[model samples]
Target: MNQPGEDFYCDEALSGRTPVTVVAETADVLAFEHTRPFWPVHVVVVPKRHVPSLTDLGEADEALLGRVLAVVRQVAADVEREHGACRVLTNLGRYQDSKHLHFHVCSGAPRHPDTD
Candidate 1:
């Protein structure tokens, strides 16, 4: 679990600020749709607490981590049902921007042909 002194993004996605539709949520995790989707269907799953990064997760957060993964699986199943297929993604260190641990569930192919 995250405590004070940690700096991370708020649960803004839960409010549907992003392109997410909020599939489910728990004490520690949240699942939602992606606004500018990488694929036809894109969703982002995140931990509610403010963990600076995946590398910053503490011992007490082990269960929370497990729950996050479980939600990923459940959300992935839901995404597949809705979009036919899906991809699970997580970033580390420099690749992460929000500074909070989150997973992106992507489905279908890139919308723009110019994208690589």
Candidate 2:
């Protein structure tokens, strides 16, 4: 039950309101299976803290971003290894449903038609 235009990661997942099946986790990042997956093998990597968007990062967020990307890399590698191929992506601006900086590591065809 995520609200539109809200930061699902910070407001739900990070806050422990929404339970997530963790794929990988680090000191500053969390990679988990998407609550509502768009692809067959879909995982999301996000920073523990609330960063508005990828483009909104400041100097203080560099280390955190690096950690987040590192987790994303590992998760993407795991998905690609098991699924043969995978896509790693992040949305920005109006394309982003949630105002949290998160990356999708996914493989296979879209589960929902509207996702494509």
Candidate 3:
């Protein structure tokens, strides 16, 4: 059964929405676009399992956690190549909305003077 914040990443899924780039995926994760991105190359890294919070992770989740980071690195590298450069970040406590453990990979700023 899904937990309270497990559906944090589900907003886009449930809404049947799509983002600009869905770079990669694994057995336990999905990488997609950030709806309200803070950077030029913004992507969201989500786990396939509906895990409600990073603080709530258990023994079984340890491996999944590691895999998430691994994917983040790979994706970040790709983002740099494709978009030049980017940032990888994760929110905690009040910073997180979905309560689900996710990573935000971004490249460049929301408004770069060079772009404008």
Candidate 4:
């Protein structure tokens, strides 16, 4: 179960409290399979360091964000190649569940009705 206010990527995934199947990794970024997937094929890419949200970036975060996106691009490309189609997205403000900057690379129909 997830808490109401928590940075799942930083507190669980990046901290290694929750083991994840990594798809790609870098010094500043990590991409892995979603623990609880909302789609048939779902991958999550995030900065290893906590950055509250996309709009919360600072000047120093630009490079890290680029690295994160590079990983997202690779993961999305792989998913698209394997599944024929893919979607890359990120939630912000009220739409974000976890308070961490992350992007979803997914393919195929959503597995859950509540997927956003």
Tell me, by lDDT, which candidate is best: 2
What's model 3's TM-score? 0.75
What is the C-alpha RMSD, rounded to one decimal, of candidate 3? Answer: 4.0
Model 4: CA > 4 A from native: 1-5, 58-60, 113-116
Q: Candidates' lDDT values, in order? A: 0.73, 0.87, 0.74, 0.86
User: Which has the higher lDDT value, candidate number 3 or candidate number 4?
Assistant: 4
Candidate 3's C-alpha runs over 4 A off are 1-6, 14-21, 58-60, 111-116
The TM-score of candidate 4 is 0.89
lDDT of 1 by residue, 24-116 (tens): 888888887765667777778888765556677744377788899999999999888988888898888768766678888888877884763
Candidate 4 or 1, higher lDDT: 4
The residue ranges of model 1 lying beyond 4 angstroms of the native Cα positions read 1-8, 14-20, 58-60, 113-116
Per-residue lDDT value at 53 in model 1: 60
Using TM-score as the yardstick, the better of models 1 and 4 is 4
Per-model TM-score, in order, reads 0.75, 0.89, 0.75, 0.89
Between candidates 1 and 2, the one scoring higher on lDDT is 2
Weakest lDDT window of 10 consecutive positions for candidate 1? 2-11
What tens digits encode model 2's per-residue C-alpha lDDT throughout 6-82? 88898889999999999999878999999989899999999887787899873336888888988988998888889
* Positional deviation of residue 17's Cα in model 1 after best superposition, in angstroms: 7.2
Extract clashing residue pairs from model 3.
86-107, 87-106
For the record, the alpha-carbon RMSD of candidate 1 to the native fold, in angstroms, is 4.4
The CA lDDT at 50 in model 4 is: 77
Structure candidate 1, residue pairs in collision: 19-35, 20-33, 21-33
Clashing pairs in 4: none
